[model samples]
Target: MTRLLFAALLAAIPLTAPAAPSDPYPSTYAPVPSPPVLIRNATVLTGSGERLDNADVLMQDGKIAAVGAGLTAPANAQVIDGTGRWVTPGIIDVHSHLGVYPSPGVNAHNDGNEMTSPTTPEVWAEHSITPQDPGFGTALAGGVTTMQLLPGSANLIGGRGVTVRNVYANTYQGMKFPGAPWGVKMACGENPKRVYGGKGSAPSTRMGNVAGYRADFIAAQDYMRAWDKYNAGDKKGDPPSRDLAKETLMGVLKGEILVHIHCYRADEMAIMLDLAKEFGFRISAFHHGVEAYKIADRLAAEGVCGALWADWWGFKMESLDGIQENIALVDRPEKGCAIVHSDSSEGIQRLNQEAAKVMGNARRVNIDIPPERAIRWLTQNPARALGIGDRTGTLAPGKMADVVLWNGTPFSVYAKAEKVFMDGALMYDRGDKSRQPVSDFMLGQEAAP
Candidate 1:
């Protein structure tokens, strides 16, 4: 009787186990198809100065598999009808402080500068990156797929900066640009001196600034010698205890890292070039080179790229002589050594417009820089500076599918980013106006539609 009662109760209650609690939002995002995606009937800018009209581009497994006209998609491929739009490789910013100085604009959030000392080669910028910063989304909206988040120029040897993908993610490691070489942020002239001098430090003058750099590099050279002896099995005992600062500097000496120096004046830039020669290290690029036009030929001869602002000058003593023809003069046909850059959060959003302004200035000065070449300032040139040229900057087969589709000519004042893709994934699509990636922190805080 008892067995029968138990069996009856079990049968009366639900025999099927209660449905396990699931995520109300089960991973609905579909995986990228293997056969690839086909974008048809669009204008393609190959980043090699080649433009294709009514072109077809295919992306497979996160890479550009094919690009041309009259190409057919695979049977199971996803298709995007690009009736009328301009497609170009994703924009790269060699000098950016996005994650380090993330948005929400708070003093507590500032992480780009380790101003505790005038030389902090021990620090690493990637360690300070806040991947969940809202500014990542803003940069994505502007079609910036990859960027190098650099440490500030507050010190002579600021530290190592890291390059990262502008993917919406929760961890910095998840967004790090795979295999991108780290960069050392070195500064010259006013910034370091001013930062330290005001605080009653050694570098109170320009000469002092140079001395500080020389001293650090000299020490770095000695540090390298120690490491070399240890590595070559010539030195015994303790292996010269690991020094993070010297490790970073040795990376530069070994050519495993790139050097990005920030300077404003022409003479200071020349001094930095000489310093590079003295130290036997390459000067990858000069950031905020407002006076680069004054010695554009020298910069080109040294194989150094100048990152400048379009029409940004006269705000400081060093930039008093700045002119609109800066980009034009540096980008002269015989001396192609100029690139427009945006160090400001707002300016970064419209790098295309900044390049356009430089183009306009160049045209006015009778310098016939083609629109394609000017576009290089925001795309190809920066990729070269950041050392990711072969990967994401160009729309070539076997390259990552970092592409941007514009509503109009990217140079136009009214042009806007219509769609953006990173690694064959549709990260931003204005066509789907309803779907936008917002951080968890912004979920209910933002006003609803």
Candidate 2:
């Protein structure tokens, strides 16, 4: 029966549609403009372990043109007085379900999880995202300039995740982070078993969960072979047509997409690692890896990042053994694998505080995680995980002007996002608190302010 269903789905894909012409210069390719803005007299945390106190950052044509002290602002350039403020690259949440599970706190807006089946490789999170869902404003207020909105882990192969800029736009396309590759949200252990078994599906157990993933990946492998043959102009007989679902999976096989697995247990993490080895693709990061410390060395050797909560644990059976030292342990200098992630709306707003807490706890145990290295958990590391490092992760020359200025020590709980700039444009300024984005749904509501 499952084979018949799979064959039916495969047959539904169109085999002979004319291919669209590719653009030589895609929309993301924009010309660099002269200096448009300058931020002066600030403490710059470059996300590369370099800090420049009383420094100046020059923005030209939507990129960081230069960074130094005593830099001259171009004539007619917008000068942001960053006196006494700390500037850092905008925060990047590698694991977020903001838009897919968007708010007004309604079940109708909850699109993150497709729990009906254990394998849902066809579903894409972008299509389910509501751009003006008001969460974008909250993320921006928290200095989150770029975030990956992933599908929830209700299935073995949930869906492809979309990376988007935290900007106000009419459509998701406008908010989409150009040139950022999509991610496949895969899961292991309890989530798949629980979600599918509850529905009386084939994957009601751990072994069943593994079987489900293997089956889909095997199908994806065959799907890619068909497409490769078609792309090679071997249309002698009726060529297998394009399947959006299989196309996404094929993208993973071709290394065009990243895999972000949500696994909690160490044994399951090792299993997934072995599975990745067998499948010949890398697992970019382990999201909600509370037990990551147990396998930090292996993860670091594989260059797989561990995206974890600072101190969250004990909310469920799987996360029972989660420790606050997870991040610190994974971040050991010898191991070199850790990223602080906020899987909640509230947590996203205070990611810095989360990192701070992790650092503090690590220090108490004599694990000296410097603030500079800790910042990477929320910045450079995530950007690399999302494949957007070139554009916005650091305040490097030719990178996007996505920057955040804090009112106090970013690691301090008292600190707040004072100003945020994207593409050299001022999007938020707390001093002029009136400029913050208030969603249409939030407008005229009594509790909005």
Candidate 2 per-residue lDDT over residues 1-449, each given as its tens digit = 12233234324533322212321212121222234888899988898778889999988777888999999888989898888888899999998888787787787897888776678888888888886677778888899988999999888889999888776554566567767788999998787788778877778899998888788888889988877787688567787876766777788878889999999989899999898888788889999988998999988888999989999888888888898889988875754768889988878988999999998998898888776778888898899898888877888999988889898679998989988888776777776645576665565666645
RMSD of each: 10.3, 8.6
Misplaced by over 4 Å in model 2 are 1-35
Best by lDDT: 2
**Tens digits of per-residue lDDT for model 1 on 68-88?**
998889887888887777888
TM-score of each: 0.89, 0.90
lDDT of 1: 0.79
Alpha-carbon RMSD, candidate 2: 8.6
Question: How many clashes in each structure?
Answer: 0, 2
